[model samples]
Structure formats: structure tokens, C-alpha cells
Target: MTIPKSVFVVDLNYVVTLPEIDAHIPGHVEFLDQCYEAGLFLASGAKIPRTGGVIIASAPSRESLEAHLAQDPFHINGVAEYKITEFQAKKHKPNFFD
Candidate 1:
């Protein structure tokens, strides 16, 4: 059986500019792909209302989680920023993984 994990929630405000547009989107996509390959960011996408980004990631600790996110190109290129917040979620169903 798999052990329970800590799922972190990341909220990105937004970036409005040509440099940010060119750097942020592609960078985020590349980072997301890497996360998928690494098995850390289970799921990630843009937020509702088109504000910014939302990522659901699993890590050992908040610092580790931030480090993982820091690898994202958007962050490295100074085109984007993130607010990492811890979350406590409850789920119950016949098929939780479904």
C-alpha cells in the first residue's frame, strides 16, 4: 500500500507583460512536464478567473515543496512568483483515486 502524502497548494497572482508572457507560459509547461516525470506535481493548471496558477504537489515538507517549485523556469526567469500554502483536505468515497 502507498503511504499518505502531504499535498501542497500553490497560488500564483499573475504576470502581465511581453517578457512574462513569453517566459512564463512555456516555462510553466516545461516545468509541469518535468514534475510529471518526477512524480511530484500530481496535477497543475491555471486558476479559475484567469488569475494565475494552481498546483497540487506532494513533498516531504513545505521547504522541500517550495524547492521543487523553485525549479520551475517561470520562477527562475523572474517572470512569475508563487505563494505556497498548506492545505488540509478531506475525501471520502468508494473510489477516492478515481
Candidate 2:
């Protein structure tokens, strides 16, 4: 069976302090890079107050996406809780990828 493409908005809420979050940033970034290389992540960044972060990604299924997210250092270390919302990307600018 062919899996449909699903877009997800991953909202990360810090469960620990900022210093704790910082301690794992390098690993988190490495994970993000891997996701990007695999065409799973579109964009990602921290919140204004550094409380957490957000990631825009696409996956074949929610389960698979969740599995991939579980590999993040933040998740592994229990430093943050992730709230994932799936949405349909019906349209986009022609140059949006540029």
C-alpha cells in the first residue's frame, strides 16, 4: 500500500529548565539535520523565550513520525513534551522552496 504524505506541526514544550535544554541542543540539532537530510523536516527553530521549539515536517504516517521524533535527544532525555498536529498542505508559493 502506498502511504499518503502527511504534514505535521510539532510543538515542543519544555518540561525542564533552559539550561537542561541547552545541554542537549547539540544532539537535538544533529537529529534535526538527519531529518532534513532524509526529507522529513522542512523547518525548525526555538521559541522566542527559549521555552521550547517547533518543527514542520512531513511523514508517511503519524506513527512513523512519532517514532522518528522519539529519537530526538530532548525526547530521549525527557526534557520536553511534544504536541503534534497534522495538517493538509493544500497550497504553497511557487518559490517557497527557494
Candidate 3:
């Protein structure tokens, strides 16, 4: 079988105040939901100190992923900056992507 595409570990660092970030949570969640439904996002959550968040995701290409991320409310509002790391999955549980 063909190998899957690279997975992305997205690190979001808040660029604005907590209150500003909080204001965009709802829209951000909506964006996350859409990504999950589209099978682009595998997992996501806030950081321990609430400074930002992290998301595990995959897409056909890095460009595709970046395009999707551009729609996030955080991005739109300039509330957070993203740092993306890509890796090939050499090992994983059976059907982990399923």
C-alpha cells in the first residue's frame, strides 16, 4: 500500500491577550470541527499554561494545510501565530488514521 502523506504538528502561540483569544474560541472551535469533519485534523487542545494551543493534522499537501489554517478565526484576528512541523509516520497503531 502507498504511504500516507506527512502529518503536521501545528503549534499556535498566542499573539494577543487572553481575553482576545477567548473572544475567538467559538469561531476557532467551529473551524476545528470543520477540519475534523474533513479528516484534516486528528487531535487538538490548549497548552498547559493556556498560552496557546496545538493541533495534529494531515493534508494532501503543506499548501493545502496552510490554506485551511488560514481560515481559522485566530489567524483572521491575528490572535495567534502558527509554527508547523511536518513528519512522516514510520510507525503507528493499526488504522490510526481511520
As for model 1, its CA RMSD to the true structure in angstroms is 2.8
Off by over 4 Å in 1: 1-3, 92-98
- Give TM per candidate: 0.76, 0.90, 0.95
Off by over 4 Å in 2: 1-4, 95-98
lDDT of each: 0.71, 0.88, 0.93
lDDT of 3 by residue, 1-98 (tens): 34468799999999989998999999999999999999999999999999999999978988999999999999999999999999998887777788
Ranking of all predicted structures according to TM-score, beginning with the best and ending with the worst: 3, 2, 1
Q: Assess candidate 3 and give its lDDT.
A: 0.93
Full ranking by lDDT: 3, 2, 1
| Candidate 1 lDDT for residue 82 | 88
TM-score of 3: 0.95
Q: Write candidate 2's Cα lDDT for 1-98 as tens digits.
A: 22236889999999988888889999999999999999898899999988889998888899999999999999999999999999977776554332
Model 2, residue pairs in steric clash? none
For residue 5, what is the lDDT in candidate 1?
56
Q: Give the higher-TM-score candidate: 1 or 3.
A: 3
